[model samples]
Target chain A: MSSSSAAPTAKPPMRDALVAAAFRLFLDRGYEQTTVDDIVALAGVGRRSFFRYFPSKEDVVFPDHERCLTDMTAFLAGGEDEEHDPVARVCDAARMVLRMYAENPTFSVQRYRLTRRVPGLRAYELSVVWRYERALAEYLRSRFAGQTDGTLRADVIAAAVVAAHNNALRSWLRSDGEGDAGTLVDHALGHVQRAFGRPADAPVRAVPVRALPDEGDERPEDVVVLVSRRDAPVWRVVQEWEAALGRA
Target chain B: MSSSSAAPTAKPPMRDALVAAAFRLFLDRGYEQTTVDDIVALAGVGRRSFFRYFPSKEDVVFPDHERCLTDMTAFLAGGEDEEHDPVARVCDAARMVLRMYAENPTFSVQRYRLTRRVPGLRAYELSVVWRYERALAEYLRSRFAGQTDGTLRADVIAAAVVAAHNNALRSWLRSDGEGDAGTLVDHALGHVQRAFGRPADAPVRAVPVRALPDEGDERPEDVVVLVSRRDAPVWRVVQEWEAALGRA
Candidate 1:
């Protein structure tokens, strides 16, 4: 048996064939009803070969996610060498996923449809998506370390990035990948950038302060003006105020 | 057999005993090694009674998440009756999960430790958390339906709320729930509220804008002053400008 197996060494093509055969079987027979034997028989491979390529039947549906995740991590690591913004780097990492799906439209669309039908697969996909989000968050956490509200900012921005990326990805999947996925992802990601990203040369606009008309001759002797970025947390403003008061 | 099974009709104590017995068995003999039969035998209950309370052994560890999820959903539903802000409503819903954990500190902390050690349980917990986030996002989607960037706002805010809640919950759990969980949750949630929530009577502060010094004495006849909310989307600002130009 060992001698026989030596001739049919499991190569990349063999793995690809097994994955295609497994997906075909899953689509025809349904994910739950399909057995490992069915997949192996269709691929003309032994059970050992099937296990070598995929740990389980469900693993076949998402064969490339492990590679995709590794590639994303590498992309994020490479970004640290440049003068890139952390949020933009994370968005770029998410775009890698879009490129992967766009590369294989038919398989991606079919997998999306199949996953929507299977609760287990949906949960598995959610977990996978979460790992991607955590990678982004960890990267941002390092970038934002020592700043006030850094951890909260990291987690919130990571979640928002993932949500925005999924919004675009799901929209493309829903359309059967008919439109330009890159454009959809860019549009969706733009919302996050506008909300959180700070451009290097963003202009400061002056907002006019209007005072209420004085009621009769009881005029105020002094007027105190307060200003802050619309999105600044109250705690941060309070901290700034305390620092200034301490200086005084 | 049916008549005999009626003797141990699953009461609250039975469920509690089953959970306690399962956790003890899991600790003594690893989670992978512990069998349903072992749990039933340890608890001195029949297999049918064990299955009646839990669908599987893993379910024993996360016995109350289903109930907590239901309670959270119901709270969100009830909030719609009052004219509550959506972000505040979501934060209150998240507090429900904290209350569940706070109500059973030992079990919650034990489960958290167990889940951190077990990969499968961690994935299950992630899926459960995703469900909670989705429910919050759906509620926000309805509340912000007609506003600009409503869907994006709904998803981002929902994700932020969940992230903030989890940040506080995990901190308390890491400390073994010894401190005031409510105070920690409130402090974490305040970051989100300040970033996204609309206070009942939030003031619109007048920001005094300083004009840039002219490099050359090219005094323009007209000084165009444009003011918009800092957080408004660029497309919205453009639309407002277009509308104003059309009016002019």
Candidate 2:
């Protein structure tokens, strides 16, 4: 599908054309080898037009990022309705970002490749990602304004959501072909929720308290034995704990 | 004291000398006007020596960043003893970063100014900051392994700590003159801890529960009140329920 076919487009096709040409040239002749003039020539646009569309050659690689950021901000600011839970609102906000990447997987993949090779572009992308985190944090802060841990909670939640989104997006991009990006994003978000969403003050009334061991015994009060190492079996640790508790 | 009068010095004087020279030159003749040759000449070092010390002119502006990062990594990695308490370890790890910035306020101030003006340097600095967050998050994940919310907790703690550090550092730098930076850093770290250190899944046995009364011939069980704000006063809400129960 041609970009020109879109109806009532405020931006000229030359901008998208330049971006498409830049990606093609970058992939064909390498990012460093491909010049601004080459990109403009390939797109059949003049030198002046290229500059008008983009401040620098690098701008061609990440077209509409600013627009996406604005859209995300608007979406978040509009999520002030009291009907939804804070967690739901956060997930919806994260979805806005996932949808953006999913909408243009081809361009995103090309951009990811170029970013990997170019330190400057990679840094730029990171900065953009940080901005998203900032926006999300701000929204969460506003939503949880009266809480003592509002800012801290907001910051952590924002970071976790962004990290999960990034991890999933990177996995998708790394694969040779795109699959169910939506499902991946959902799964990633679930991972984040499970990781950080444990109720900080959940009722502990039902917790089974084991009695303290006798004095002069090896087992110390206030000490909980936990198995360390990644490959350690979960069942083994649980069994060991249960046996130790029995002895106590 | 001269840089060379070293007694197991933390950082070489030459590095400090180069940074000072670069900052002065950047301020005197804009960032773009300054050159690597000028910095080396001002620092009383040869071009070859400068090259040996720093890879590029930009490196001089952020001389101790790599060391700071290394120190932070070491601090986090050294927390194997407290592996079960990810929150405390992450807080302490973040404090090490604040200490690094406070150790050299003058150089940090100059670096901050340069970063603000030079887009390239800003991007570079951001990448380093992101790396610090990444390291903190990874360490948190390792420490919090097997917890239901381990990854999310790690991500949130890392992000909050970084944000708190940045906020404090920026405030210190923006002031007309420096104050007790250590105290400020402590205050910031405390804020972060209070926010994210609340033990997720910690027993909420301390929470007081209250039942509400029936109203207008409708059973209290039929009427449900939803709290959408995270900051809603739980104690007040409980008190209201207690009063309603008394009425019943």
Each predicted complex: what DockQ? 0.30, 0.12
Give stretches of model 1 more than 4 Å off.
A1-11, A205-248, B1-11, B205-248
DockQ of 1: 0.30
lDDT tens digits by residue: candidate 2, A140-213: 88988998657656776777688777766777887732797778778878765543443232211111233367
Residues B53-136, candidate 2: write the lDDT tens digits: 788877877776677777778777777765346666777777777666777777778778878999878777888888888898
Q: In candidate 2, which residue pairs clash? A: A156-B156, A195-B149, A204-B204
Give fnat, all candidates.
Answer: 0.35, 0.16
DockQ winner = 1
- For model 1, residues B1-248, the per-residue Cα lDDT tens digits are 01212346433888989999999987788787889999999999999998988887778988877777776777777767447888899998888888878878998998898889988888788888998999999888888889987887888888988988888898899999899999989988887776677544422223323346478746522222334333332333333333433443
Query: Tens digits of per-residue lDDT for model 1 on A80-132?
Result: 74388888888888888888788789999999999999998998898888899
lDDT of 2: 0.67
Say which docking band candidate 1 falls in.
acceptable
Candidate 1 lDDT score at position B89: 90
